[model samples]
Target: MNSARCILSENDCKIFQTITDEWHNSINIEECFLTWESKSKCKAQSKTSFLHTLCFHIRGLGLRWGEVLLLTLNGKFDVITLLETGKFCKSTITNAFPDYNIFYQKGGNPHGGVLILIKQYIRVSRIQRDV
Candidate 1:
């Protein structure tokens, strides 16, 4: 086997080339190189063969919970984890996403909390821990 690096353009994108020999000693080369022309095509091909899962981690969901929910709905996230929720009541958080199942851990302080929300259609289990 032999390998070499080729630079595509002014941006200096690199593509690796590999050469292999068959049992008959004939050099057989495959499409191991990702040239600029094929880079976008490869990415398009990958999207169809891949599963798209979106997860979002939000730092603050206190006053911005509505905005966060809007973003989540637009993005169609599979899971969302929120930190510093600034919420003490479980009903308040649960009411935000009626379509999803919510698990929450309230922090010692009024300004710190964590919540995890997953779509109702997804199968998930919650494990509770005291720390």
Candidate 2:
């Protein structure tokens, strides 16, 4: 049986170091992405694709995930794309791909903000903090 109060000793670190060293030098971007997906247990392929799109837009244009997800379809262009390209047209927020759902805070709520699903797992710390 495993114990919860287990302390990671130096021997544990040595083993972890050896395991990490095996993949540290050869890991590529695609492999890193796959590893993240596997560790996150985000099995829904649509969710993974959403995260990839979100990460790319976040890194490329420095926009928050909430901003990207809550973008309205009626707008002329997505703010991030427009700000980057200086052109405005019908937004693609709803078209092209509709498999993913956008999360946002509705009016008449105490906490006013959008929620973006960046990962598949919720941290215990977050649950404690919320309560």
Candidate 3:
């Protein structure tokens, strides 16, 4: 489900942890996220830079929503693809994330699903793929 796959580097692991830890102490804001990660190698300095996207294989997004929220907020992700989200039905998770629009595809298996989140400000139209 995560077609736009970008591998996280070793340093990204450190930054991810740091951001997650720091988010706990910071106030939550709906608009304008801190781009601390952008200063690192994580972001491309070019003006042609695209949206910040991350594909995370969180086994279950149910219990760890707070953590997910913190990470996404601190990382300043514009789009996120949650892979292997277990046992969630389509439309059951709508409005789960207030600022982001949700799109999901459930699989036959009890423990496999795909959840895509795009920021509300990003104008996106769904397109079908032959895959």
Candidate 4:
């Protein structure tokens, strides 16, 4: 019984460790983005190799898809994060930006949501969290 309990505890530790590592990476990415944004002041500068990420508070994507499209093209971004996107129809965003893979989370309120778009060539998986 003790051995079984130890094994379960060990497994839980490993799972939590993985989650911590992912969160750390997320923080690092956010830091990098903020640093870049501060230096560039929201200029459309293309990155060389690796990932070029851009995030925006689009408020409502349905109203600004065209503007986002232009930024994606001009900046040559590999990942784009849109905040407060309101309600999303996956097909609408997907059809508009066929080059990206969409991942989004709707908020409890009508005026809140987040949408992430990763370039098709880059591999990504959405992490699920239980409420």
Which candidate number has the best lDDT? 4
Writing each residue's lDDT as its tens digit, candidate 1 over 1-131 gives 12232334423333222122222343322333433337678888888743234444445566676777687768766677777776545687677678888877777776677777777888988887675
lDDT of 4 by residue, 1-131 (tens): 34545666877767666655555675587775666566565454444347799999987877887888798778978889999898767887888779998888887787689998899999889989998
Candidate with maximal TM-score = 4
Model 2 regions more than 4 Å off: 1-8, 11-15, 25-27, 42-131
- The deviation in Å at residue 81 for candidate 4 is 0.3
RMSD of 3: 19.5
Q: Which ten residues in a row have the lowest lDDT in candidate 1?
A: 15-24
lDDT string, candidate 3, 1-131, tens digits? 12212456667766666666666655663211454544443545554557899888787877556766678768977899988787654454565567788878886576578889898999987887987
Worst 10 residues of 2 by lDDT: 79-88
Any residue pairs clashing in model 2, and if so which? none
Q: How far in Å is the alpha carbon of 66 misplaced in model 1?
A: 3.1
**What's the C-alpha lDDT at position 87 in model 3?**
65
Tens digits of per-residue lDDT for model 2, 1-131: 02312555667766666546545754676785677567568566546532122222233212433455455333323112212211112235334324333333332333233323222232322232342
In order of listing, the candidates' clash counts read: 0, 0, 0, 0
Record all residue pairs in model 4 with backbone atoms less than 3 Å apart, i.e. clashing: none
